[model samples]
Target chain A: MRALRLYLVQRVTAAIMAPLVFLHLGLILYAVQGGLSAGEILSRTQGSFFWAFIYGLFVLCASFHVSIGLTNILQEWTSLKRIAAANIAHTFGMGVMILGFRAVYAVVF
Target chain B: MTTTHKVSIWRGGAEGDYAHYDVPARESQTVLDVVTYVQRHLDPTLTYRFACRVGMCGSCAMTVNGVPRWTCRTHVSKVTGGGELKIGPLANMPVIKDLACDMTEFFEKWQKAQSRFIPTKTRKNPMEPIKPDTPARVAANAGIECINCGVCYAACDTVRWNADYLGPAALNRAWTLANDERDGGWADRLKAVSDHGGCHSCRSHQSCEAHCPNQLNPAASIAGLKRLSTSAYLKGELK
Candidate 1:
């Protein structure tokens, strides 16, 4: 893929993640301040598809965002290029998505 | 002003040490003057490069006090800290000798950016009339005066980190050509600069703009390239 396309992808994912990260942080604050117990948190999030969807999208965007940003960093710091760089970035993205989705599933179910 | 000043200069290629020399300081003296004094009086074997002894040629650039500058224009008083100076070749490049860096990569990047203007018409056709006041022409005019001094390239942290990155000089030249309305090479030029180590690699650190002797803003040019690439991609014009 062209670097322009990758640049766009990274920026788009960052844009998507920014608001989601803030909202998630706000939710954490709310939950802690409300003295919500583990049971209460579970009860609130277990069946809520809305929270699941938001977290899922967050995970997906963050995965792509981090991988792409790290790939750029690797290119700058090291001599990694072409297929090697792309493959490492893609592998990182896949790992993050898988781990994040599993965590989301554990929380939502 | 001191009658003599301590000057530490890099004395070897690739791997070397700073050799100290006492140079006679004079009124209205440039840094190049001090280097010349060392080579002429103290060390006959000291190697350096300069031409025209004026700012127009851009051949006398070197690191003065850890900052890349036109040595012919930089005065000893301005750069001397505590009665000492450290002069060396430009950073982010292979040092060919004392105070001279290899410009092969710098020129290579310019070629890779494909910065030459491609005329759309043959000589038989009428000359194209370009309005100087147009926004594109004005933007092009603003960045077109670069003499390839390599100061910006030396000052760039991106170039320090990424060897493949097309430094500010090449990208600035590319921006000028990209804005040329009569140039027929936009598609290929745009594609060339949109690749890895190209315009997208710029972090907008502004070091290039800050250190440029001509005061040209390469960060702005790279931004223009980014905007152009985005627009070209959206419009299906980029190949």
Candidate 2:
């Protein structure tokens, strides 16, 4: 049941990440090619709902995906059993979300 | 031409190491040929299993140099390194003796996965013709060629980790039954396969796909099962 939940979560996050990944890559290329400075980019991103929502969703999906994937690796490679691996994965997911939201807030709000 | 190859045969049970023997190699020599040479001439006690010299019987599978292959068809040139060969029992299984694994658990998982084909009609009922190109039949065709060689079972790391996890062949068999139009036990089979140690337990490492002797893709079949189970769950069809 835990494995199923993780698989579902990973699939859901992957679906979200698919488009977000392309959009993120496109934005990076567009920004770099347009010769936008770090400060200018930050200013444009600041107080923007669009940028905040997009980046926030991306971060959530990414965190969930990475956490699930890492949990599998830890369970397979290390001595961590199911419950311990799951707890560690949840903790890591929380860390990603908190840190990610903070960085998004720093830029957006 | 009396040609020879230096072969190392595993001599004991799970606790055994490789013992070296120089055997006369023949044209189109197979790994089974090397083992037979060692047992017949060099040592009389070397143990292995093979019925058909051809690949049809699915009985002569072993690990040749860390790769699971059918010993009858696997030529010496394909696996031997520096004229040295190491043959061992299939991994992820209890070695009953030299090169023969305890396939009880292996076949038992097949039963657990409900791999048997259940008929929906009797002799009085008219025959239902199945189209070869139908979507479900096509999907079944992609995975139905398994000869029960245990090659994929040996190659699967998920089975190694979780003993209850249904390995590739069993899951592949389940997928075929799930896609069969005439099979009445689809729901029951899916329920049996969707639990913690079933299709959901697969890590998608694809080692089974890599090592299948018939070159069948069990990974794709398992993915199909995952999709089927998820869809069944959404429709409240999964028991």
Candidate 3:
């Protein structure tokens, strides 16, 4: 069933994000060893394929996870039906992915 | 000195109101005893349901001061430190009268989860030998004592939120069957539980575990089903 597939996708995205979140936090601490300078942060991330891929994957997973969570919340809380909730969540996910990847591109490119 | 405590009980249907009475609280008097006193001495029209006076049958479950519990086992002195008792029907179901909830939907969800055991062998065959300590049997043994009391159903937020969700008890029954080695139908059962409104809907609130009088962990059983669903999804076994 589609519900089963989506549930699995939600779980997998959560699993993917767990370690990435820790890594991102660790990066924050490591980067802030000096003052919180945008230039230094961008200098470290700029033109780095590793940083690009890591943040890119993090953004993708977050987009997927948050969308499914929103779908569940909308179904439970709002008057919207299942299909309507999924549609809204999908659009929301697209927005998240677009904004997130744009930020990733700005930092990595 | 005999102390009379205030007892408030819900009367009528979904549009019900709590009726108050003064009941003499006795030493080791169960909540069921309080209800019995109200019915026998105070109000003859007050309605409730119970089977065993002792704790065996779970028919006496009610919301005692907001917590779902088996009234037969819950003593007034243990629960009522404030010297007050508030009793009502089990939640998340249609109240038949006062303390009784219609269990039709509760059992219907059990059927919806495909909880029936599929026999691999008929009566003509000898009994299949299943070892006691095996992992499957151990897992099956963990959740087999459910008495269909519907307490966990009353406590579940997922069941309250998702109309389609097969609540804790049904999925717990499915888990026991899934671990049954002799059952040749777990494949179908697996797919059934993996479908929409099945095991995937549980949010791991553990309210079922917290409220179950039988000490069964439907939450753990649901987690097991989720793991199976994930493995099956990855293997392309479930589509």
Best by DockQ: 3
Q: Rank the candidates by TM-score, best first.
A: 3, 1, 2
- Using Cα atoms, each model's DockQ against the true complex is 0.59, 0.39, 0.76
Q: Write the per-residue lDDT of candidate 1 for residues B198-217, one digit (tens) a residue.
A: 89989999999999988899
Q: Candidate 1: count the clashes.
A: 0
lDDT of every model, 2 decimals = 0.89, 0.87, 0.91
The worst-scoring run of ten residues by lDDT in candidate 1 chain A lies at A77-86
In order, the first chain's TM-score in every candidate is 0.90, 0.89, 0.96
lDDT of 2 by residue, B130-217 (tens): 9999999999999988989999999998888776788999999999988898888886788788877799889889999999989999
Cα lDDT of model 3 by residue, B92-192, tens digit:
89999989889899999899888988898999999888999999899999999988888999999988899889999999999999899888888888888
- Minimal lDDT window, size 10, model 1 chain B: B75-84
Candidate 1 clashing pairs, residues 3+ apart or interchain: none
lDDT of 3: 0.91
Question: Clashing residue pairs in candidate 2, if any?
Answer: none
Poorly placed runs, candidate 3 (over 4 Å): none
Model 3, A23-66: lDDT tens digits are: 99998999888879889999999999999999999899989998
Rank by DockQ (best first) = 3, 1, 2
